[model samples]
Target chain A: MDYGTTPLHGLPSRVTICEVGPRDGLQNEQAVLPVEVKAEFVARLVDAGHTLIETTSFVPAKWIPQLADAEELLDAITLAPGVRYPVLVPNERGLERALAAGVRDIAVFGSVTETFARRNLNRTVDESLAMFTPVVARAREAGLGVRGYLSMCFGDPWEGEVPVERVVEVATRMMALGCTQLSLGDTIGVATPGRVVAVLDALAAAGIPVDAIAVHFHDTYGQALANTFTALGHGVTTIDASAGGLGGCPYAGSATGNLATEDLLWHLHGLGIETGIDLQKMVDTSIWLAAKLGRPSPSRAVTALGDPLPR
Target chain B: MDYGTTPLHGLPSRVTICEVGPRDGLQNEQAVLPVEVKAEFVARLVDAGHTLIETTSFVPAKWIPQLADAEELLDAITLAPGVRYPVLVPNERGLERALAAGVRDIAVFGSVTETFARRNLNRTVDESLAMFTPVVARAREAGLGVRGYLSMCFGDPWEGEVPVERVVEVATRMMALGCTQLSLGDTIGVATPGRVVAVLDALAAAGIPVDAIAVHFHDTYGQALANTFTALGHGVTTIDASAGGLGGCPYAGSATGNLATEDLLWHLHGLGIETGIDLQKMVDTSIWLAAKLGRPSPSRAVTALGDPLPR
Candidate 1:
């Protein structure tokens, strides 16, 4: 078998990875990384073969001070030609900043649960969607690719359990609006395999193509990988993962961030799944970031594979 | 709905927890946990509602230096009435020591993979089983309950994949030898949901009672909980988990330990399964143990809970 970028099956010769470390990851860290370090980290990720890199979120500085350098970071970082770096844009203003910073791809997010929408983004579910409509329209007119995030699609902290129909309705609206792909976010990380199956079942029954669906899960409760397997078993391929489990939800107190890329890739490779990302490189990057943050990694794979500390 | 210890589906209103931190947990840690700390830790676990605990192994001290104080720890720890403390016995000699220590239960382990068995215990698969036959017979005659472990039942380090038939054969032989329950170990943590389903199906087809089976999984590749879900869906009730995701095979270089008890309980509770362990208490104990080890807890759930660090 070829060591680098080998095909899993005859179906495809490669896998596309959407690295969310710079955006989802850095935003969740308690220690705000310096702009130079953030630029270096993003450059390292690009060097490590991450194609679809989520650069930064264009949220207000007061909302998430960690990524307040979104504009500067995007401008300072060296961009490679084939790499597609997408920034999170909440409104036309955020989109304008991203476009000004030379961003060719932008992502807009809304919530499925009204309670979470109000608490997280300070808007109602409908209001959140409406806020993104103009952003999506303006981005599409600028020849930019648009991706919509449906937060708390599986469950919400305040609402406990979300109805599948509500998630589907929001997802359908996003897809119908100029968004090319819909990523379902299990924001609070309370999902199980059965619940994942239930959500996918409802969505498929609603005449949604599995190809348009991407699953995002946090490893807060360690169900991310299982849920990912369930999603993959449903033939929904796209997955969003942080490089080192670097992100955590501030609202969902004590919630870990997105699934670790190293851990997720380890399982994918073991199961003969073709994910183009390198596992060892991802582990090394996690080690570096964990040291920078003065902590052990949130990723189990990185801990297990990295060098053992002297007793 | 009550969150307290109430009966679910009329199956025992309470659960019997067996903490493997002493034998299964500490043996896999790089640094040796002091005998006093180990004893105190076991005492704390017992105080926190664990009635049955696997205290330590009877293996030679030279083999695993980290657990060299097994006898001392077992001797110094206070045992509660009706609390069954079991120790692993590799052979007749190991059994003699455990029996002398007043242990009421003895566990004998055999691996499904010949390669893992040889690398792990310095004996081939058949040789190891042959070595355990007399130990099991002796434990039975000595009026001690016997539990058998089939390691690498899911996957192995040297051998990439293990067949279900191989696991069934080992399980059947162990059952015929008077082992009360067979704990299938996912040694390298490569078992996925589909593979777990297939293994359970094969075991059932061979007439193995689901109730008599316990699943032990490592989160090496993040599939332990997923595998546990598959086992539970098939009616297997008993689960084996470590306190803080401690322990890994000495043979498998970077394999993670068993799934964290807190994470497993969270999923089981979400599924409405009756595993009478308190989630909060488990998290507290894990944090306490991590403090003793002077490192972050391997469990994401423990860290995510964001409880104050143990003094």
Candidate 2:
């Protein structure tokens, strides 16, 4: 073995990938695949050894009609015994719907930017967080796993440069209020490797454990992987990625999509890190869905692997 | 600074970027830009703070007709002071042509995989390296800088998993011949962060200094940035990138272009590395060139920064 070729230090040994395709990816799609197709996609991801699958969002139908079938999709999908299936909940109502659908894991979202919060959720940051408090309390009482999302943690379209102090405050508050994990989202794809480190450094000063932190970055700026490395260097273990690089953040103007799961796995697996995901199968599912949706996958990895089913 | 939210460990503080758009990007293009356009592109890249620009190839017109104007473009473009503009020279004939054109820096090409060499250059590995030895010797005598490129340093379509020993022998021989830099080219874009670390480790064990190494990876797998980080961890300082994510390796099946310069800068700059390149300006140039080529830039960073140009 060429010891010279292997990295001597600062390489992540294992990375926990949180596949957000089912929620973040499918939610933005205009052509909704049937609920069964959605379930099949999630199952395929599970079969590929993805441990954390964000199945669907329980947002009001009026808000995002595309994910109106979230309950049915969650109920219909076969749950792999060890896999964690989480659903997105906007408020107490959304959490009620998710709990009724037998969701054991729930995620609550809030925006660090005030403009994005008002535009996306029709509530101010304070209002949104206030609304989510009950939902988090209920979920904890119901013995459900809850993850808190601080969207636009780095920068926002309406308000650029989300203050690190504000992000830390919001994250600390969320985690203090029954949330087990806090993912800082770079909604507009503006986070650079430097800024990621800066933000992580700030969070570290606040005494947050590296293992509890997750990063959600968009590929819009094409810095997603680089940002991931910044997070990894900070010892962040959980990374959020979408399958096939699907799903555009509606609030993020001109942003393309999230980093693709296949691409993410390729890097993690290549580093000798244990991601526990199969690359070839994930490529197959992305191709299947891209064909059904009649849109090319935004993932270069999927394209390079070839559209296993050539139309 | 709300330092409590930051994760600690594994992040890079700075990064190195090598711009290859003018050479690797333009060579694979079908609709060749005029010599003036090429010259302008180089000037703009220099203005954008690109320190290392691979300007063009001295290969025969029959091979890559797109870059036949290499000499004219080099002559027309004003070489920014302190910028190292390197051109690819396949053998003695190519080197002679480049030398006559007043080229001060040249890169010699070889392949790690036997089949790829035969298919790409119509020469066997030994035959190709044998051809480069004389060119390397002549260039050394001329007091010009010489760099050796080992293509398919990662995986190859014709022959997969290029052995570290093969790469080591080729790289060691090139270094012995007085080459200042050895660029490991992932022609097929299949390298993961692990593979990158593995390859770099192998080379280091072979007694190669990390500072003398450069990496050229394709975004075919969307792991270029990730791989770059791994390389940085091993102390590899130079990196090869294409402007606007311009071109794919024609011979490497499914290989996309080098990682985009704008994207690379985003990551590097983020890592607190002083690349001295302006992000907004870089994106503007990429968008301008993408229009000139009558295609959307393959650079997601350019697209994400969308229309930074004043309307």
Candidate 3:
């Protein structure tokens, strides 16, 4: 009854959320929780009704020690029958380590911006895509779901504005490599709603359906929810979020949190879109996670639902 | 040049920002800065290209100790010709004080929820409206700008959902009382974009032009920016924001902060709407204010631009 008298329009009937807190979220955090604790966090998220939970990354321990216990964490947590636990794989070696651990879902990341690809992934755009080709081929042969993450699709701190045509080019190639899904990331949070609309349109023109696209926005400039609104208007239904709006870009020193899962859910549920995710349970998990990190959740919904000061 | 290749549609070319930090923002803060510092804060806001600033409140000292020096602050600050400083006056007594101080603009507060009016204002809605009638009349007689603020226009903590019809009725009365503008406040931050669109339409149907309306939203649920985008689509160009998201409600203890001025500027400028507000100068004022309060600004733009940690 509290849904208000207004009829909603131009949004999806349901949404699929991919929780990236365990991998992308924690990897940026300075404090590393124990592997057992990480497993517990994953189990709690699954309990919160998230079907696609990104549990860990297969990168070397030296690169992201926070998620270094990927194998241990994967073995320790319970994976529900309907749930998907995708781990980030940088290359064939990372993919091998993940396959050896019985991971059936994995994602490769590259930047649409050339500078980000070189500085972060140590390759040019062509080189990074080339490196991912064999990895995706192998994953498809193994009957696993492959996803591609395109970072800095909108703007980059160093490379400046990236053209939408360039993003479409990279995304189409990733799809051609047998990727089932591609997430467009506004890594620096400089995206506006109009730019999101343009990029989505351009990608559509490049033969990628809106359903194949997921939006990933950082909340550094507080444009994530608005940008998400724009994406929904374009019929893009999948979104990537971190619990507690976790994750800071180490590359961009001033970037803060991601678009929080709780914040995103609050708006989605309010719009009468079924995400199949429990709001209270997600809030509990975020509160628990923030406690482990010795900070309050930087999420408006979490704060609105409870006290914000850290215990 | 970075406004993107897609031209915006259904949005205004120019927007008027009503800076609410000094009044609505600082009123909730516990640490009271000296009157001199408050005066300097107003002057800095004027320098930041804000044409309208809610500088202080005329509420009694016992009620709001933080702004007890409203008179001294008004006298101390230099008033720029192009800028307007509006003071919040609760009733006849507050209005008399403001008039004696040579104030040119004042705002009276009411609520769409009767419970908020009865409990907080200690009067029923009818009694409060009756109380504001003479105040607005005298202010108009003195040729001063009179604005009306209606809180809990969306929903209330105790009253649940507020009907859009009720908001329209109360707002129409206020406008008839000679108030130039009526700002609808989502005091609890529960409104979605659809609800905002409906409410704005209802107000318009009631003969209140969208131009005579301003929107005020709490970022309690991270919906402020998204709701703002909806307002912009409806041609409601005036918005209320707190610098550094400085305000919190003592009644709604879980409520976090107001929508930050810097955060709003980031997207509005990105959307190519001219607000005349200087982003860097607003950041500087927020930084200075946060330092004086000995806390970090809870603003994403502040964090994205630089660290807001205590000095």
Best by lDDT: 3
Sorted on lDDT, best first, the list reads 3, 2, 1
Q: Model 2 clash tally? A: 33
* Rank list by DockQ: 3, 2, 1
lDDT of 3 by residue, A200-283 (tens): 989999889988899999998899999998899889989999988999677766567889999998888878788899887989
Select the stronger candidate by DockQ from 2 and 3: 3
- The DockQ-derived docking category for candidate 3 is acceptable
What local lDDT does model 1 show for residue A4?
Answer: 18
lDDT at position B126, candidate 1:
81
Against the reference, the lDDT scores of all candidates come to 0.78, 0.82, 0.87
lDDT, model 2, position B140:
92
Give the alpha carbon lDDT tens digit for every residue of B88-169 in model 2: 9988889989888888899988888898889987998888877888899999999989888889888777666677788888
For candidate 3, give the lDDT.
Answer: 0.87
Model 1 Cα lDDT, one tens digit per residue, A138-172: 88898999988888877776667677789889988
The fraction of reference interface contacts (C-alpha pairs within 8 A across chains A and B) present in each candidate is: 0.30, 0.50, 0.52
Clashing pairs in 3: none
Q: What DockQ results do all the predictions give, each relative to the true complex?
A: 0.28, 0.40, 0.49
